[model samples]
Target: MIGTLLTFLAVGIVSIVVVWIVLSVVGSLLGLTMTIATFLLFKVAPVMFLGWAALKLWAWARNNRGFLSAKDRRWLERE
Candidate 1:
């Protein structure tokens, strides 16, 4: 009877420790994921948006060239 009780207690303690370790690992992974997401939002997103805007501006300028006269081009160059 005593041996059975001791075995049950040991198993219960081991299961608790295992659960605690698993939770700690999961929390660390969640923190790392949040950090990477924050970096992408703050650092990478602005540069990507700026590149997109620059491409659009360049396309508009290229399309605008067909309507301008030579005199307008000269005036623009002088300015």
Candidate 2:
């Protein structure tokens, strides 16, 4: 019957709409997760580089104390 067909069509449309909404929510969450990951990477990258630099400097100072003057050594030691 036409009434039964119309009812099925309405149900189908609503089901599609619900699925679309769920997919949108999932997409937003994925985008937010990626944004947070990138933000964290940006935040930690400089600290990582500075740590590497400090390690390099320490190794250099250990092997070549004469390369740095007494005042420079004092300043590095203070840090």
Instruction: Identify the candidate with maximal lDDT.
Output: 1
What is the C-alpha lDDT profile of model 1 across 5-59, one tens digit per residue?
9999999999999999999999999999999999999999999999999999998
Candidate 1 regions off by >4 Å? 67-79
Worst 10 residues of 2 by lDDT: 60-69
- What residue runs in model 2 are displaced by over 4 Å at the alpha carbon? 52-79
Q: Pick the candidate with the highest TM-score.
A: 1
Q: RMSD per prediction, one decimal?
A: 8.4, 7.1
Tell me the lDDT of model 2 at 20. 100
For model 2 the TM-score comes to 0.59
TM-score of each: 0.77, 0.59
lDDT of 2 by residue, 1-79 (tens): 9999999999999999999999999999999999999987898888998999999999988778657778888999998
